[model samples]
Target: MSDINRVAVIGCGTIGMSWASLFLAHGLEVQAYDPAPGREAPLRDFIAVATTSIGRPVPADTTALRWCMELEDAVGNVEFVQENGPDAEDAKRTLLAAIDRLTPAHSVIATSTSSQIRSAITADCRHPERHIVAHPFNPPHLVPLVEILGGADWAVERSTALYRRLGRHPIVMRREMRGHIANRLTSALWREALFILQEGGASVADIDDAVRYGPGLRWAIMGPYLTYHLAGGPGGIRHFLDHLLPGHVKRWAELGTPVLDADLEAKIVQGVLEALGDRSIADCMRARDAMLVALASLSSAADDAQDDLRGDA
Candidate 1:
């Protein structure tokens, strides 16, 4: 991450714009580009709101941002490139190949594709070793997680360091895989939740609440693995794995495999609309950002209290 101050955001959609905003807030020079005309204003608007949402001071000067209409111009001298193209396989391969040709050999190229695997994305790249996946959660300006997969060790270290510099938690994968880490875990939960909804076992809002109020709150403290380790009490994980683990196998076997056919799709649409009630998308987004900030504060305070207790001990 040394001597790397300029980053090219190669697509001005939500993820690209949010990346540009976070970079700008961290005082990095951002060269933003999109094929569509008249995206500069929207990107600026998004950056302004996003910066506020994350409690970062709005970019005092927009001079640090360079809006580009051409791909080659954006990546010419950038130290890193974040491509946010549509999630099609051939399109991403073509776009990455073009960026690879234009960008300097030293710059790391990362895709913001949520599910596309590395082999497909880097198929046409002249230097696939530096090409990697850097998927950020939606509303990435607020979410601190960035999932990294598929890169040479050097490129991976640089990218991971860059994310840390921006105060993001980046998880590097030991193996290349589709859907990466977070998405795969969540998708399994979603499959069963949808199956339950379709079967009239739970309302959409109720299912959401089950996670949001229950496992989600616990997950924020420690993930499922550690939480279950505690469930074994004095015996800890060794005892749980040896004794209690078999009980979960039957539950896993009973999980549903749901298909989102037309009727189920319509049910989901109606249920979600009802759940949303009177809240607009903007309203929900604002509330979500606010809660994320509050949760971060809570975690920080909990860490401080734990440190104090350790000192007493």
Candidate 2:
């Protein structure tokens, strides 16, 4: 939205490569950097596979990104930088210092950090005002939501606009909370999933199927609150809450925390491997992510249609 076409991706690991692919798919020039030598070829291969798998257009005149050995070189001439390094505080502090010094004043500095808050990472930066945490789901190129946090209203507004321009849904957090919104919600679900597994109430595949077939279907179009409101029939969410919430809370209270037992961990690993079978984990994740991307695109289209209908009304 700000003519910010060029993007720099620092740390070209799994998340970094995925972010790069998203930018490149949208015809944005990407400059990438990683300390590992010969990583460029593998990164390029990942982009190719992701683009094909997601059915996203990889332009014929596609300018393959410049891979730099130095971090500053990657940030050069770019309007945005998406950092995807290790989650260690010291590592982030060092990287942010360098990015703060090198990046253009107006460039929007974002991180792929899932756990850290914006303030923690950007505290050392000279222009902390220009920094925001833009965390995307795994396979960022595919998932539509980019959770944006930090800065004042203007910073959040600009970051939201930029992500929207890139065809992403940027959910701006009202506060700089740890783990942000999506991941926090995911953590809640995962916590329950662990309880279910530990209680021997559900298998891994059963839990997966429950989501892929049940509430996940409605979640594609609306938030859980809205879904519950609809479930209330003519009475709305308050009525449903009065009747249903007590039972829900009771069930949640009864669930136990997962024990960090080696046997359980081994069983979990075996279960996942059995689910995946011969398919590589990377390949399986990519395929699953591609479906989610298409689902998100469809949902967005539906939202647009509903808005248009409302306007006509």
lDDT for each of the candidates? 0.88, 0.81
Where in model 1 is the C-alpha error above 4 Å?
Answer: 59-61, 301-313
Model 2 CA deviation exceeding 4 Å by range:
54-56, 59-61, 277-283
TM-score (all chains, Cα) for each model: 0.94, 0.92
Query: Clashing residue pairs, candidate 2?
Result: none
Q: What would you estimate as the lDDT of candidate 1?
A: 0.88
lDDT of 2 by residue, 1-313 (tens): 5566788999889889988888887777899999878889888888887776667757544666777889888986777888888888878888988998998887878877888767777878988987888888877877788888777566677778778877788887777778888878988898888777877887887888899899888887789899989888898999889987788898877867788688778767877777777899778875787678678778778889999999999
TM-score attained by model 1:
0.94
TM-score of 2: 0.92
Determine the backbone clash count of candidate 1.
Answer: 0
Model 1 lowest lDDT segment of ten = 53-62
Native-vs-model 2 lDDT? 0.81
